[model samples]
Target: MSEQSVRRPTQKSRLARYLIPIGSMAAALSLIAIIYLGYDLAKGRISPCEAVFQESSIGLKTKISFLKTEGELEIGREQLAELTERAQMTALNLKTCCTVLDAGRVDPEQFLQCKGSARSYEARLDDIAALVRTAVKEGMSTGSVATTAATAAPTPPAHVEEQIAQEVEAAKAVSRDFNKQVVQVRKEQALETLQATPPQNVTIGAQEREPNSDLLTTNGLSLDTWVTAAIGDGKDSDYFVFTTPKTYRDRIRVELQNRSTTLEPRLRLYDASKASLGDRYNTTTGADLSYDFVAAPDTTYIVRASNYYGESAGVYLLRVTPTKAYDAYEPNDDILTAKPIELGSDLAAGIMDGHDQDHYRVETGDAEAQLLVTLTNSSTSLRPQIRLFDASKASLGEQHNTTGGGDSSYLFKAAPNTAYYIQVRDYYGDAAGTYTLTVNEAQPGG
Candidate 1:
């Protein structure tokens, strides 16, 4: 081979050597860039607000984990668990918001929604952090264990435990207040958006009638109809009356939309006797109000709307809708209205609200017989109970299911032609749902 040829081959070898390392370095740099970009995306690079919220959430979770590890802490396990669950939920919501924001194609409404969610998460995380800090501080102060030569676990002092409980309750109350504020913020934002563009396909049935400030001169409102109204001045209030359908009991939902920027709406409900059932109002300016109740059949209910501060005056929209229909045996919530149930017949009914009670009357023929009253709970949250009363409203006996959504039966001897009243309700009086009640005569000598 000639010297020129050998020299050309050596030069080519050097060039190949240089290109190999250069290619490898470029590849390595590309990999590093990819890893960095993945991390940046994951950390919410598109939304600095979301990034800050996420960091705060992570810090809160860390504090909660630290609290959970303190086995000797006097904090209630349930409270800690609740705090953890709430923290997890906050984190999940933040993550969702971040994802939406990072998508880069979100519309204005979606962006606003995500921003609102982030704000809510931030507030909730702060509340949770405060709660955790309280628990940690209380635990540190009261969690001292007595030790001897041999290891021993000692109970906290009674006073210390009581103090911790009180502090925990107070912290929980603070958290609840924060949660309410968050909800109010979301509601206000929603109302602003909704008022900007009213929902489609909603029928405006009637307008407010004047001289309707009091219940006596109230305007008549049809069920499931929207009414447009306005508060002329601070003291002005609109009263609308509607009677529940006589066919069946129903769950009535009342919604008030504040159409003006200056108005804070307040809503109140009254029964036929002018007794207040409940009231809902917007604490935030320009926010809407909503309330729901189980209305008995053929009952007249009055709705009153006014400015929340009684100062701001503006136009508003009101609508009353019946959301759910209950069983035919409704309006039998007391001894005076107990529905009659025949032997071997099963009737379905519902406990529409926490305070609702259903009463049924059973009469036996002209013979002494053993009566079996069975109540089967249909909702997972309902622990059904049956109470027996004589015709004179004297209590005879009661039976209730220990487990939720279980069955209960009461057996008693019924004299001929005697009337017994059966009252059904949730055992705890804090749950609502449906159940089936059966009245049957026991077989003789079986």
Candidate 2:
């Protein structure tokens, strides 16, 4: 047959051979281009902001994982749970930031917000790390999980908006030192301005015209005098100052009564240096609170009256007066100042002051097998507890009874001729009343 008639490969088959190889090559090249794009993204070969977002996302994931491991090592299960939760929240916050960045070019305000949020997360992470360290230390020392954790370090202050208005005139009468006297003057002026134009629907009594909102410039309170004032919105507090000389007014009583049924009254005491003095007294709305404290020599004291709820506005009556109330013998609240008691001695005393604890020392005979100590609280509401310590102040026995009565009794044998110390304290730290104590010897097993 001739060549053409013999069917030398058809044109279609000839073309298919070359086209198939070229098509395969083209497909392989396209796959390689796609892979290169993926590689570029994975390597962060992107704009600066996009790279930042990518890095942050990865970093947050790494932190979450790290926190999980650290949490496992923590001794406190609560701490571990808190850390895990915070890590998860941080991961979610990072995602939110990434979404914002992905939308488009980052707006200035939006970027700042993201940055602030990131900083907050970082601060929390630091705090958690510190807490774990502290917990580990405390556990090693006490052989138990710590019930309290130290507070975190302060964070950097945020940027505040700048004032655009022209600056006001400088003060002419004030000295540059800005002492307390100057501060009081400024406060007085502010008070006058506030009183002259009281808030709508609010009234300031003629007797309570001055605003004694600060500890330094508290309104003066004379003994046995009663005064009334109204609390205003948002941190409005009234402070009253009184003198308690060691000789004349050493024992003083302070009373507060809330007149408004909707307002809860709270009171706090401060010393001349503005340091807090005792437990904060608070009562239900319209209830009264009375506090007695033996003041230091020639000292100035402050009484702070305010609404317990921040938003509540109401009126309260306050009185500071000298009372015939018994004072806890001064300098006897600690082991160093313990009142000495002999065998078969009966002593009458009072807790008198809020938070007061009475300490006594007793001498035991070598022949004596045991000592019987009894306490009777005068007030049924006052629950007193007795703690007995050896001469070294190491606690040996304790008796605290509430079901039977507010009284406590303990019988224990001490080391031969041992000097023992007894302590009396209120169970809840707020009870104030008188108590009678007695101690006697008894035979063992009797």
> TM-scores for all candidates?
0.44, 0.39
Residue 354 of model 1: what lDDT?
74
Model 1 / residue 36 / CA error / Å = 76
How does candidate 1 fare on TM-score? 0.44
Q: List clash counts for every candidate, in order.
A: 0, 0
Tens digits of per-residue lDDT for model 1, 271-389:
98889888889867778889888777788888899987889888888888888656688778789989988999888888887778899999999999999998877888788889999
Best by TM-score: 1
- Candidate 1, residue 118: Cα displacement in angstroms equals 58
Best by lDDT: 1
For residues 159-224, could you state the per-residue lDDT of candidate 2 as single tens digits? 100110000001111111122332443455467666766432112333454557775446777667
TM-score of 2: 0.39
In model 1, which regions exceed 4 Å deviation? 1-205, 211-223, 232-236, 241-250, 258-263, 270-277, 283-288, 295-302, 309-314, 321-324, 363-369, 390-394, 401-406, 415-419, 427-431, 441-446
Off by over 4 Å in 2: 1-216, 219-239, 243-252, 255-300, 304-319, 327-331, 366-368, 415-417, 428-433
